[model samples]
Target chain A: MKVKFLCIIALSAILFACNTPVTESEKNGSEQSRKSESEDSTHVPLATEKKVELKREGIFMFYVGAFEAKKMDTKKNPMLENKINIALDSISGDVIYGHSVVAGNIRPFQGTFNLKDGMYTVVAKEPGDNKYDGVFTFTLSPDNGTLNGVWTSNDKKLAVSERSYDLKKTEFKYDPSLELDGTYSEVYNSYNAKTEQHEQITDDAGKLNASQVELTSKDVENMYRRDLEIMRNAIYARHGYSFKNREMRYFFDTQVAWYIPVSTDVTAELTDLEKKNIELIKRYEKHAESYYDVYGR
Target chain B: MMLGLSTLKNKRKYSLLVLLSVYTYFLWLMIRITLQYFPAHDDVAFLSIKQDYVGMWHYKLAFFIHVFSAIFVLLAGYTQFSESLRKKNPKMHRRLGWFYVIVTLFFAGPSGLIIGIYANGGTSSQIAFCLLAFLWMLFTLMAVIQAMRRQMSSHRAWMIRSFALALSAITLRAWKYILVALFHPKPMDVYQIVAWLGWTLNLVVAEIIIIKKIRS
Candidate 1:
């Protein structure tokens, strides 16, 4: 009876974990447009609002490199590289409104667009709800199609108060053919605390494409924990899903060159094959016994 | 002379107590490992890859029977091998010995054989497990027959062999941990190697012990 009760609790937990609310994308789209339409007529007009409307609207991903202040030790605070995507959802005249997607968090930003002497410059400020919120001052060069500039954090006391970025205009499209390449061979993240070691994933992980093929136990039964994890996340990375897991973010942002941070939740974007493969991979992942020079069954 | 014999007996008893304590600790660890399968989820631990077999009713039944019975056989087998218990309470020793033999022959061995056919790591591990289950049942049966025939020495030898095969449960996991820690082999590669090594090494030790006894 006790075992049965424990089973109920365990089964309930598994059920809860598996339960992802199927969001109606159509409903969300209509609701968003309705909200925006209601706030359209505010009776506030700027000088250049009608004259200079920025035609460039989409996701511009910036490769940000943050460094410590000169007085601080460079060795201790190395140049931290990360990618943030600026999504220009609405552009009306001189005022451009959008959200910045970075490190699995979305911050709504609004700023002014100015075109002076054939060089387009923009100053965007993120909503100061977060401590790490900052202002992005950047320029888009028509010749190179790149957005380059510096981001100054609202909190000056932060170790990395300022970061510079060079962004390229990239469009996100789900390509099922995308597979884990050789760049993902070395894991820069995922430290094994018990063993004090990091994983060097084998090439076997690259052999099978979780997004393309339906996986069988024979295919994944022998894979290491890190290998399985990489294979599983490769599906998400392909969909431009910003990972909340720090280890996943570090791995994807640094290694996967094509990965674009777009949305924190991409459940609705997952293909049926990808969903099945995810379930299969997760089953194996839970069972995968990673070696760390520690006692295990 | 009596005092000297008593002291030597006490020393042997102390050593036996130490050995039993160590065995008990390992048994506790094994129990914890077994509990991970309880309220048995299809994707639990080793069952992760055995989804193909886990779906089959016979395979599921056999797996649970083998897992649940193996623990008792392990605990009961230890008591049967206790020299002081055998000497002082032969009746109790006989009962526990019969319990171990019956459980192994009727439940654990057959169920083990059933699951071994579908064992992971493909053909190599399957063959190893099947052979292990066969040998386990065979040795235990031989032990029972020898006891019935009053062949005390041979019964003890056969029981030693049978118990060693049973110890494969623990030794296999130990070898897996050691091998993976040192070599970092792939999961199935380690499984294939440990599947054979788990029992073969124990049988070799059992033979050594048996030969030492005969010589002594």
Candidate 2:
């Protein structure tokens, strides 16, 4: 009995240690598939019958679920349900994707569209600056983009499964009878989670409370950096692009960066508004050094 | 008695009582999460695990099976260690022991093994949990087999080890809190270290109880 128990223990240990799931990529050799998808194959927009200028920017909201069609009761299941916020550009038809402002706190997406033969295929990928990873493709309806598409990524390692989700989009701003009574502003606390730094919160008398922790110069510097990042992202979002500190890509550029993945369905061109936003961002960057110096960071 | 410690049994009972209370409290927490938090459909604060199980019915069912059976076994499994209860009420002891072993092997151990693979902090953490699951099942099996063959001393020792490992679910969280309060280690580092530390520490204590104390 003792020997039998010992042998069982040995077998069980071997079973567990040996069968710990390694990534399928290692087994299937993803190097080859990666090679095929590795190329920066930029798809140019094929000119169709005629161009139509969009006059109204619509606040688009999308509901996403993972590969479930009919019975999508997420409250009783182990699937991801995401609420995505985006807006379509009034002039260029480009989509501006915003962070979730809630859980998952997804990063900004710069999306472009291709309207060819009355079939609209839109592709959006997260900018390098964003902490999230994924590429999405949407098949847009003709009248306005009522979105239905698939969001896919193979990078996630959970269950060695890809995060291939289906999305449904509704244009929130296009409702004719919509009205707002009051301007709403969400007041944020002095301590920012993103930067792990605290800023001074002054009372009505403009006095910092005694209870507030004094910020070091380094804290001030970090806050400034986060502010700069938000402003920089705003600039990139204007042109339907994301900015990276190390190697950023602008839409107006003639060539694409090697790191930008191959997006087959997207087509975009630089707009006048993008050019203006770029100019403003550039001016701020040029003078921002002095501003930081004034803050003692 | 073997180690000339007259108070050994009392000491063991006291320590076991403390651990038993702690274990009961943690199980209550799990039950609270299932009944109150999950049903209310609350927003995920730090982790999205609630979302994961809530969004899929099969996963939710599996989670409940693992949780309910594991906690039930922990509650019932400890009573077999009482010397007075075993001597006086042998039938109740045998019945409860059978129920604990059968439910654990059939429901708790398998379900735990399934979920242990999906443990967070990446592959190393997953491996740690998987080994834990394996050992949990192995020790329980050894205990049952030893009982069947009338090796009472060996059976009790194995049971102690099995319950020690099973108590890891409680100790894992305890170690994480202790580590964070003391050192404030990185989240991933804390998770990985605590995952290993909980079961290893329990097993060490179990060995001490068995070798120096439980010989009869």
Candidate 3:
């Protein structure tokens, strides 16, 4: 009985050793599929053990310059430009898994796509739990480079009920040297009921390259709270991080031209320099006196 | 003559009431600001960014010492400066004066120097804070020494100077609000400017009062 048990353990250990390479090969196969989608080549299956060819299975980003309203409305303006990332988990069948990031809200969407007359017609719907959830009806070019769509709200009573989006395919690449340019003045949103004035920040706020350079206290000490916030978020923006903070979303979605909201989590993508800068910037942000009403010095 | 004397006394009483009211209101504001550190979390309020120093036991000790003791000295100003208090209750006046002097020289002043060395707005603000702490101790020391020597007028002038620096705690925040409202400069830029302006402006006014009112 002891000899049989020892033999069984040895066989299982050998099997586990063989199983490790299969998982590693599966990861390489997924990575190859991602490359194949961009390279427009036949998906190369890493191992004969796995037979399925990779289809459209990676996240695709589209830049929607403006969500133009169909009808003119005085109360609500739905014409803001933004980016949406559609994660196509599977495309071989009618079912699709994806999510769209808009103004910091990530809403999961399920849809269908069909090719006819060299144009792919697509229909997708967000979950009905949220009032803002809507139907996306769009057409993709033959090459899947551009997407044109119209969104109709689930709730008709919303100020702007229908809007159209003409989306240009955007590629996201992480670059550490990118900097936020120009000056912007906007009314900061806070719980303080008294502050209604627009706080203006200087171009000096944009000069520091937080990702590439190790920031010192002198470099960021003079920065306003808003500037520090922008500086820190710019690091994440470079990695295609989709911001959940409303202020960051508004700033990146509206002002930053290079920003593409591709993923909700970008922790693994952060370099050591970037991670350090984030910690430093966050410390300054926490101590920033200007973020709130001028109370604590 | 009696009517004139009574009216003058009434006028002094009224002015003291006004001063106390204003002081009480500012004290209330300071108290509210201080309450942010009640339970003493490592990263709260001003200490949030000072994570570098929060780990050090001495820095933490010094910070709380300065924060907790400075307010008592500020309160002591009311009794120490009041002529009626001094004349009517000399013993109470002396006690409060000693309280203010001792706290400033030993606790508030030294701790202020320690924290000021690590002040946030860089070396310029650090210099401003360190100088302010040193001057605070110096003035308080001189005030006590003058009182011991029975040089009442000299002691009064030094006390005025000491209190002006002490009041920087309040004026610095006030300047922060004003500068921020007028020009939305960077937070630390405002801090560096107000580091000097907070006390210097008060000292300037104090000097004017000393040369014109007290010296005359």
Candidate 4:
């Protein structure tokens, strides 16, 4: 009995250790079937032929340019070439791309477009000086007729922009309608137009705090630098590619006509308005050196 | 006076065996509950097999068989050597033995074989658990056959070995907790070593009991 038990144990041990050919084939066949089934189910969008109507809308366009530093050293904010352009194209029928040559070799250029009232994405590609590109998505509503959004980099809120402002003030107030909650439609419609026109009164002060808070030039520059460093690290780590200069220009150029209806009545006048906004942005760039001296790292 | 003394000794032996068997059954229940709720570790290999098999229909069928058969085996193994129970209710005891042996052959043994292939923690853990499970089924089969042939002593010895393997499920968990208490946050290496030692020790104790019974 003892010898039989020992022999049975040895035989069972051998059987378990040896992977027979039959089991191997069975495992492979099952894996292959699962793969084929997964491949069969892919999503395809519906194709529709109906023309969509867009309402007449106006957008105020301007550009904001700044630099970012690399590394977290307290001694000096390393001169990382991070430049960004923000163009608020207000009801502009023509899309215009322009560059400004400012003092201290700081040139900020932008492309403007008036998009239809719906969801639109603004992709600022390798915007000349910045090592990294940025993509911003915002909704253009017929009622609001403005682009109001915040820019964030490296998980930090960088800047906030509004339709009318040429230079983004550090201490600008925000309309409560822009808060992310689904309550924005009510706030936008219920406000007394006359009171808001005379006094910039926001409906919800506490929720709009982040938008109202002003960031110093130094803060903007620091944020820009950090964003650039993040981009550089991502590229070096083989995670993603940096946007080429031409690709950036092409995206901004293509989207302009879609935003600004070139065939409409507001085309010619809107073009001049955009040109003026560009000049105002350039003037701000001239004072940017002093802005950097006080605020830039 | 000598006859009375021998009877008392027999009574003591029977009582000790019964007490140990009952104690082991409760310990097995505790181990099962612990494993059901608080599993040993969450390694990838263990997770993958569990995801693919344990949660599937086929595996569920097998698991039910193994669990129900184990309960029967525990009951039968506990009362098999009970002198008073055998005298008072021999029919009931025989019925339980037959049920336990038959259920184990049809269900527990086959399910155990299927699950043994996917046992985690690599080859050694797989070998330890799979061999233990297979040996359990084999011993129970032999015991049932031997009892049918009226080889009562042989059947009893094999049943002891079969019960020993079943008790491994209990001993493994006990040793795990004991090591956990002693070491206070031991690593995977330490636990693996303990798993091996614990199961082997239980088998050795069962073997010692079997040898003693046969010699007597």
Candidate 5:
């Protein structure tokens, strides 16, 4: 009887957790609600009255969701998989316009963003007379300026589709003096060289900084770039890019749950993000190419 | 602690006071976090519904279960360790125990596991949280089983273990703060490390409590 009682109690708790005041009719709409009217896709952001503030500026990256492809003069890439790097000006807080290797080649883009009343709408337009546009809906993080949301293509040229997004601020450098080697090492050698020339100044600071660290203008830039690279690499691994083995596959196994395309087939159609990620990996490949040629694929 | 209580062992009395203090602080902190959702801050997963797409509602539900049920879990579980409540108000003990068991098994553990599958830290953090949830439910079930078998001591031991797992929520935040102060490590690193240590530390403390009882 006692065992039965305890079991019933446990069952009741489970039932209670599963139990919401939502009616059968609501349950019917739960499917609709999940596919939010915007995305018309499988998932939707929960609507809440919450507001978030975003004022800091750096490299804020976004996961591109869906795009309506138009077989126009320019090749239209439908799905962007990896992440779009947005370099926001710290002082102006505006997204710095630039071209990234997107779709098949370097695609030019323009965008406008607003932070008001806790809702974010970022508009991205592929630069041309006839432009493919993406309107993103974002929610600001309560702890940091991270924004998470979904976006859909609104251009008449493409299909109206949507995808989810994961956006967060990373330690960002406006620029990094990369060494062109597959590896991006910090540009501290020059700073160290400069400090060596000013040995007297270095000696003065060495007394305070017990570790005898070399301060460089690239400190913030290098730190952010290092973090950004890790994120990029993780995303690359997530999209099925094996880096020096299967280590990246299990990187976040401890912190986040990842479920995905469980097929071993690498012949899948790549997303726009994956294409861009492929462009990035080519750099590593270029350096490692010589090594791989000597060894194998 | 009830502030002016007497007739308890020194360790239980002091420990209860510490637990109450920490709990009160955690309650205030969580409440402050919940109320400030209007203008979401730039961190924490408090309002993921706003920008998240598609299946975000499930995450919201899981988070709600983890949050709301935790309130009752802490309050009801606190009274369970009260000697006076057990002796003078035995009926209340049983009722509160039922509430504790129900909320944990149904709401807390299951929801925690569901959301933990989507843990932000990736793999390591996911494993830690999921394991914690599973162990939480297991310990509570064992407690209930022992209680049914009329093994009061064994039941109490399991309850101690169960409560220790529940205490992870408190320790998670506490350890985050300490680790941040010590080394300004990245947030994910802190989360990964503290996620593992949070419940493990609590279980150790619970083991100490159990060992003390057996020795005395």
Candidate 6:
């Protein structure tokens, strides 16, 4: 009986936890950060530039030399060359590849180059179309190998204009990494991943806890009975049963009267009908007493 | 001569079974047609009939219960009448019988009750369908209890009534089709009349069979 009660509590807790609102601190902090970032001009500069060298080899492949840009722009001046490589190969039917240019109609060039220790700007522009331009600002190391500081752009047309990161030898750490909170948009996109992870964790925990609780077969049977009762109440609501006291009494009686016990143990103990009847009796007595105690006739 | 007479009786019985089987098959086809073709909601036939009765959840619950119960009833009725099947597969027959009873009790009976109370065309139709669902559940429950008690004859009689109620789902549609075809009455009027007549005729036929079987 205790184990059955615990199981009910556990199940209810899990459900409540899933539906609980995100903590106020988390929401407030994130909102404040967003507001501060939007207000801070230095965090994201208006424009920057960098030099990029391009080398063309195969039909679609090009070896892009190291280049720098103030801010990486994905839209007008796409720095990702793989996209350009793919688009070129698709159009020309050759396995051509390049470093900075992304495959497709919209291609942006991007690369990394050493610069003297100082604040610098990097820019990418289409040959003749001034419409597409990307720039970024960063401070170079005295050794001419390290590019440290913030990358920002003024162009709103670019998909990705600004990012803050520290770059050393071969490592990069980008700050203000995006995380999906449990909002509608995030939930829709992350549903499959979140649900799968939840299920795996819950199943494992449930198994271990079941053993710790030492729930007898009878306890599990009672838990199922309770689940059925809840299901029947939902059904009753669906059937438009008035929420009056008498109707509720009848609904409770009917549900409790029909609940059958499920046996998970190997021992063949009670016959099906006996088990069913016992469950019904137990449910009836429990629910009836509680209802009267709470509602008073 | 006796052997020939018995053989003839068997042949007649088999022919009746065949006819019932065909009728059931056609009934299922009609139900399938209605589900597939009928608009999800009708302004005239559904909404204008009654104010208290119209809602999305009501319609959805009604449709789901109607379809689900009809399928179970079809399975149960088919097994009940199949002689070769019953003879060769008694276990399957028993299992299907229990399934039919439980499903009718839990899903069909309650949903039907709710739908019946809100039935359009007036009080008479409401009473008719309410009684139909109540009797359907009552007979099935009795059959189950009796079977549990090992009262085979009583169980059989109750089962026959329960199945007759199940068959009303099919007959109701058939009656609707015929009414629309012949008189072309407004859909609401036809529904009201068919709701009562369908179950009434089903019970009447079942009573006759029960009387004859008892006498024999």
For each candidate, report its DockQ versus the true two-chain complex. 0.23, 0.01, 0.14, 0.01, 0.02, 0.01
For model 1, the stretches where C-alpha displacement exceeds 4 angstroms are A1-79, A189-197, A289-297, B1-7, B39-43
Sorted on lDDT, best first, the list reads 1, 3, 5, 2, 6, 4
Candidate order by decreasing TM-score: 1, 3, 5, 2, 6, 4
lDDT string for model 5 (A1-297, tens) is: 433433354445445434433221111210110011221111212222220112322223332212222222234433323233232221124442322222212233445666666554555444443243454445544245565665455554563255565544443321212111122222211234533531111111111111122322112111222232333333332432222211222222111123121112222534454445433333332322221111110
TM-score of each: 0.82, 0.41, 0.76, 0.38, 0.42, 0.38
Q: How high is the TM-score of chain A in each model?
A: 0.71, 0.29, 0.67, 0.20, 0.28, 0.21
Worst 10 contiguous positions by lDDT, candidate 1 chain A: A27-36
| CAPRI accuracy category, model 6 | incorrect
- Alpha-carbon shift of residue A264 in model 5 (angstroms): 49
- As a whole number from 0 to 100, the lDDT of residue B37 in candidate 6 is 20
User: Would you give me the overall lDDT of model 3?
Assistant: 0.70
Please report, as a residue range, the 10-residue window in candidate 3 chain B with the lowest summed lDDT. Answer: B76-85
Those runs of model 6 whose alpha carbons end farther than 4 Å from true positions after fitting are A1-297, B2-10, B13-17, B34-59, B82-84
Clashes of each: 0, 7, 0, 16, 45, 27
For all candidates in order, the CA lDDT equals 0.72, 0.47, 0.70, 0.40, 0.48, 0.44
- Model 3 Cα lDDT, one tens digit per residue, A1-297: 423433354345334433433211111111110111211111211222111221332223343444556743546644344456543333445654455655445666768878787676888888777777788888866265677888888888776677787777676678887788866645234434456545555575578888889987667766766677778778888887766555566667667788877666667788999888887877676566323345558
> Higher TM-score: candidate 2 or 3?
3
Top model number, TM-score: 1
lDDT of 3 by residue, B1-216 (tens): 999999998998688567666666566566656655666767776777677789999899999988888877777645666565578779977887888888999999999999999897888999999999999999989989999999998888888999999999989988888887777666777889999998998999877767775657
Docking quality band of candidate 2, CAPRI definitions: incorrect
Docking class of 3: incorrect
- Write one digit per residue (lDDT tens) for candidate 2, span A213-285: 2322212221222232233333333222322211122211112111111121111432344344333333333
